[model samples]
Every structure is written in C-alpha cells, then in structure tokens.
Target: MMLAELVTTADRVGATSSRLDKTDALAELLARADPSELPALMGLLLASPRQGRLGVGWRGLTALDITHADDPLLSVGDVDAVLDVLAATSGSGSAAARTGILVDLAARATASEWDFLVRAMLGELRTGALSGVLLDAIARASDRPAAVVRRAAMLSGDLGETARIALTGTAEDLESVGLQVGRPVLPMLAATAATTTAALEITGEASVEYKLDGARIQVHRQGDDVGVYTRSLADITHRVPELVEVVRALPVNDVILDGETLSLDEDGGPRPFQETMSRFGAEVSRDLVLRPWFFDVLHVDGRDLLDEPLSVRLAELERVAGDWRMPGLVTADPEAAERLSRDALAAGHEGVVVKAIDAPYAAGRRGKSWVKVKPVLTFDLVVLGAEWGSGRRRGWLSNLHLGARDPEGEFGDPGGFVMVGKTFKGLTDELLKWQTEHFPEHESHRTASTVFLRPEIVVEIAIDGVQRSPRYPGGLALRFARVKGYRDDKSPGEADTIQALRALLRG
Candidate 1:
C-alpha cells in the first residue's frame, strides 16, 4: 500500500468524534493491508515502530532541509526499509548517516507522507487511532471476536504480532494464546479514590495492600531463569541482577509475580523514589540493593492464576513469596482499611490499593476491581513547555507548563494535550541541571523565556486539587501544583485526562 493511503486514513480518523466512524475507517484500511505488512502497518498507525526507538528526535528532524515530492511514490515497505537503516545507525558518524537517509526518504515522499513519517518516528501522531480502537478495527476486518484479539494482544504483549495472527490465523490460534511462564504479560491497572474508605465502596470486601512509590516490575521465573520487565514491558533483567537472584530463590520452580521493587535505607524504610529508580541503570550499585515485594501472583507451579480471583491469587502469592509478599489485609471494614492506609503512609509508602477479593486479574485493563487511595492528590501530567528559570535557578528550565490528555479534543485539537497550569516547585539541583541539558533535545519551538516541547515527557504532579478557571482552555487549573517526579515508566498517552482534572472541580 502507498504511504499516502495510510496518512489519509489517519487524517480521517482524527477529523471525527465518533469512535464508530474511526473504527470503520481503520477496519477498511486493515482490510486492504497485506498480511506480511501487518506488523509494520500497525506500528505506523500506532506511531510505535517495530524497530523500537530509531534515535530520531525533534531536533534531528527539524535540522533537515528538503523539499518533499508533490506526488506520492513511496510504498509502506520502502519507508519500513529506511526506518530499519535508521534504527541500525549508531556510533561516531551516525547523526550524519541518519540525516542523509532521512533527507533521501523525505525527498521521495509527498508533503503529507513526510509529515506522517515525522510524527510516526517521534511517536507523536495525534490521531484518535489508539491501540484499543485499532484492535477493534482488526477484529472487525478479520471477522474475529474482539475479546479474543484483545486477550491475545495482552497475553503476548505484542500488538503488531497479534494483529497479524488475528487477521491471518484461525480462531483457535488466537484462543490458544495463554499465559506462558517465561513471557511477561501486561500488568493489571487500578482506578483512583480519595480515601481507602471510598476505595472500599468501589471494591467491596478488599485486600487493602500498601501502595509503594516504587517501580512496577513483572518477574517471570522458569526453573533457574528469571526475567524482570517494567510496566511498559521493557526487559530490564540485565540491569537488575539482584532482582533476578531474588526471584530465582523463590520456592516454586515456575512462577509469574507482579509487584514493585525499591531500595530501602538502613532502617528498612523505603528510600526516595528517584534513588530507587537509579537502580534500574546499566551499572549495578552494590550499595543500593533493591528489595522486591510481591503483590499478585499470575502463575505458579505451571498453573495460570490470571483467571482466578484475587482471594485465590493472594493465597498462592503467600505460599510462594512469604515474607516477600506485599503487606496488606483482607477486610470490608472502612475503619480497618483506613488504618492500613495510615500505616502505609507512616511507613513512608504511598498509600493503599483496595482490591476486590473476587475479581480476576484483568491484565491491561484499569477497572473498578482495584482502586488506589492517597491522602494527597497526585496525577501524571505531560510537560508542554518549560520556562527559563530566574534568581537562584537561573540558566535552568525550571517552571513547567503542564498539560492533560484531550483524547476527544473537547478543549482543543483531537488526541492532543490541553495545557492546565505551570509550576517550579519540588525540583532539586540534580533535576534542574538535567532539565537544562536535556530539554533542548525535545524542543518544538522556543521564545526568549520558554521552550515548548512535543508533549513526550510524563511527570507526576501533586496538586491539592483543581479549580475552575478560564485562564486555560481546559477550564481548570491545578491548585498548588508541585512535581513529584518524572514517571519514566509511563508514556504521554497514559497521562491523566483533562476530564479527570475537571472532575476534581466537582470534588
């Protein structure tokens, strides 16, 4: 297929508010796609290339000066071949090599094709064709059940491959996709509540566990081998050998554990989140040993527990993890849940996650079965721009202009970010220096005072709440907003929505 066809469909997907219309357009496109090209096709539509990060950034793309072709001549395969070269390019002269390749590719593509290619390379396509919608389209085009396709995608943790299988393979092949002991599946997610009591209202009788401010880790163990993956499914096993040894020591020969890992101080209290995160680097620090605390067990003793209730899974988790199990109690009492919440906070943890005792683990889905509670409101927001600092913080990009995801474009552009407010609080000297040095790489444009970004960075912000305001297009502004930290594990697409911020107005 021509690259122009995909770009036109993307434009059509972005121009409408109806999800049905979007799905129909994508389904039609999928129907015409070649089976061998499904992976690359899905990757382009999702703005996540099959080759992963191509080392391409906004600055690199903006540096090229080339006039695009008036007529579309590039095929999808032609663009994919170029991306392969760009992904493989590295070392001393990689920048020049990439620039030359991009120049040639740009000259061959039409103006619209070049625009789409840039957005795809940067993972910033603002079309409403998200993975869920695309999965629906695949199911529609393949004449398969959406649930089957979704389950296959979730279990395999590869949307592109799942698309190919669902489109070309039989129903039994899709259904056969199951929890493999060694392959990491997507982690289950949670909703949020103001308090443990409120969370219990949503979850009923719940296992209220301590919600640690640590990195999410999914450990898959088979015999003596263990692999640790992040929330985004990036394999970091080599970076965390200590964690691997810990999982290897588990009594069960084969198991899949879902939990969080963090470094603790001498007193056994959790350390700062940033300090814990640093353990994820390539260099293993013997001084900072990370400890694992298992919350849910997905598989044990060659049995898949994903379909089991939380009550069953927690029992299995206790038998396998023992002391390493996350601390919590099963209760329906609001006062008891509140007590656990206080204990978690006093222990320097985030708060509590109240989980329904009877709900099965719904991987990749954030349902009401599990709800997180925190005394103070914190949200994941996108950094839209950063102002040049003043006074003691001069030469640093300090004040962050934050944005919320506008998936439906009620406030502005569809599938774009809506500016909510700005803040300069909670930044340490290390963060200030880091921002000053790295912010230019993502620069979209800049004035004398501020440098606007491409909404690629996700930062966790603590806000007292949100107040109704006309100063921003979202009609709401963050109250006493302060940075908690950068959530490197999350994507801009996972940032909290403007409607979610607006709901704070009602509270």
Candidate 2:
C-alpha cells in the first residue's frame, strides 16, 4: 500500500469524532493491507513504529532542509525500510547518517505524506484510533470476533502481531494464543474511587488489598528460569536478579505472578517512590534490595487462572506466595474496607485497591472489577510544558505545566488536554536532570523560559483540591499541586479527565 493511502486514511480517522467512523476508516485501510505489511502499518497508525524509537526526534526532522516531492510515491514498505535503517543506525557519526537518510526520505514523500510521517515519528498522531479502536477495526476487516482479537493482543502483548495473526489466520489459530510461562502478558489495570466505601460500592464482597507505591512487575517462572517484566512488558530479568531469584524460589515449577516491588527501609516500611524507582531503573545496583509483594496469580503449575474469579486466584496466590502475598482481607463490610485503607496509609503505602471477589482477570483492561481508593488527592496529568529552573536549580526543566484530559471537547478539542496547574515542588535533582535530558525529545515548541511538549508524557500530581479560576480554559485550577512522580506506565489518553478534576469543586 502507498504511504499516501495510509496518511489519507489517518486524516479521515482524525477528522471525525464518531468512533464508528474512525473504526470504519481504519478497517477500510486494514482490509487493503497485505498480511506482511500489517505489523508496520499498525505501528504507524498507532504512532509507535515496529522498530521502536527510530532515534529521530522533532528537532532532527525540523533541521532537514529538503523539499518534499510533488507526486505521491512512497510505499508503506519504503517507509518501513527507512525506519529499519534509522533504528539500526547509531554510535559515532550516526547523527549525520540519520539526517542524510531523513533528507532522502523526506525528498521522496509528498507534502501530506511527509506531514503524516513526521507526526508518526514524533508520536503526535492525533487520530482517535487507539489500541481498542484499532482492534475493532482489525476484527471488522478480518471478520473475527472483537473479543478474540482483544484476547490475542493482550496475551501476545503486541498489537501488530495480533493484527497480523487475526488478519491472516483462522479462529482456531487466534484462540490457540494462550498464557505462556516465559512470555509476559499485559497487566490488569484499576479504576479509581474517592474512598474505600465508594470502591466497595463498585466491587461488593471485595478483597481490599494494600496499594503499594512501587514499580509494577510481572514475573514468569518455569523450573529455575525466571523472567521479569515492567508494566509496559519490557523484559528486565537481567536488571532485576534479586527479583528473579525470589520468583525462582517459589515452590511451583511454573508460574506467572503479577505484583509490585519496592525497596523497604530498615523498619520494613516502603521507601519513597522515587528511591524505589531509582533502584528499579538501575541496570546493576545491589545496595537497595527490592522486595516483591504478590497481589495476583495468573498461572501456576501449567494451569492458567486468568479465567478464574479473583477469590480463587487469591487463594492460589496465598498458597504460592505465603508471607510475600500483599496484605489484605476479603470483606463486604464498608467499615472493614475503610480500616484496611487506613492501615495501608499508615504503613506508608499509597492506599487500597478494592477488587470484586468474583471478577475474572481482564488483562489490559481497566474496568469496574477493581477500584483503587486514595485518601490523598492525586491525578495523572500530562506535561504540557516545562520551565527552566532558577537559582540552585538552574539549567533544568523544573516547573511543570500540567494539563488534564478534555475527552468530550467541552473545554477544548476532543481528546486533547486542558492546562490545570503548574508546579516546581517535589522535584528532586535527579528528576530535574531527567527533564533536562528528555524533555527536548518531546518538545513541540519553545520560548526563552519554557519548552512546550507534545501531550505525551504523563505525570502524577498531588493537589489539595481544585478552585475556580478564570486564568485557564477549564475554569478550574489545581490548588497546591506538587509532583508525585512521572507515570511512565500510562499514556496521555489514560490521564485523569478535566471533568473528574473539576468534580473536586463539588467535594
């Protein structure tokens, strides 16, 4: 297929607010794609290339002085080939090679195609075709069940692979995709509630488990071999040898355990989140030992428990994890739930997650099955822009300008975000350095004092509450906002909504 064709379809997908229309446009595109092209095609449509980060940033693209072609000619395969070269090019003199390659590619693509290509490379594609929507498109194009496509994608942890399989293979082939002891699956996510009582109202007779402020990990063990993965399913087994050893010590011969790991202080209390994350991020650091707190068991001894109810899974988890199981109690009483929440908070943990005892694990889906309750007011907001620091913090992006999601276009563009607040508080020197090094990669534009970024980085912010304000588009502003941490696991689409933030006024 022509890259122009994909660009045109993406334009169509972005032009409408109707999800049905978006799905239809994407399905039409998918129907015309060759089986071998689905992976690269899906990756482009999702603005996440199959080759991963191509080392091409917006600054590199803007630095090109080549003129785009007038005629449409670049094929999807051509773009994929270029990206392959770009992904492979690195080390000394790689910048010049990448720039030379970009110049040739840019000169080959038409103006519109070049625009789409730039957006795709910069991770700024604004089409409403999210993973879920594209899964529907794949189902429609392949004449398969949406549930089957979704399940396959979740289990395989690759949308492009899932699309290829669904588009080319039979129902039996798709169904054959099941939990593997070595491969990582998507972790189940949680919705949020104001209180444990409210969370219990969502999940009756719930397992009120402590919500640890730590890095999420999925450990898969077979015999003595174990692999550890982050929340995004990136393999980190070599980096987390202590965790691998812990999983290897489990009595079961084969298991897939989902849990959080954090470094504990001398008193056995959880360390600060950043300290835990710093330890987690290090390639080799044995000074800080991270302990696993298993919360859910997905597979054990050749048996898959993803289809089983939470109560059954928890029983299996307790049997396998013993003292390592996350602390919680099964209860229907609101008071008991509140007590657990208080105890969790008292232990320096985040709060509590109330999960329905009978709900089956729905990987990669955030539904009402599990609800997290935090007494502190915290919301995930996108980093719209960051200002350079002053005084002791000079030369770092310190003051964060936060934006809340405007999903319905009530306050701004649909699926865009509205600026709600700014903060320089709670930023450590390490975080400041990170902002300085990485913020430029996401930069949309810049001024003397601030560098505006594409709405892609999600950061968790704690606020006292919201107050009415005439300074912002949303007519509400965050009060006393401070950084909790960057949520590398989440996307801009998953950021908290403006409506949800404004709801604080009522409280």
Candidate 1, run of 10 with poorest lDDT: 278-287
**RMSD after Cα superposition, model 1:** 2.0
**Each model's TM-score, in the order given?**
0.94, 0.90
User: Which candidate number would show the highest lDDT if scored against the true structure?
Assistant: 1
* Cα lDDT over the full model 1: 0.90
Q: Evaluated with TM-score, which candidate comes out highest?
A: 1
Q: After superposition, how far is residue 17 of candidate 1 from its true place, in Å?
A: 3.0
Give stretches of model 2 more than 4 Å off: 387-399, 408-414, 424-441, 446-451, 467-471, 502-507
Task: Report residue 173 deviation for candidate 2 (angstroms).
Answer: 2.9
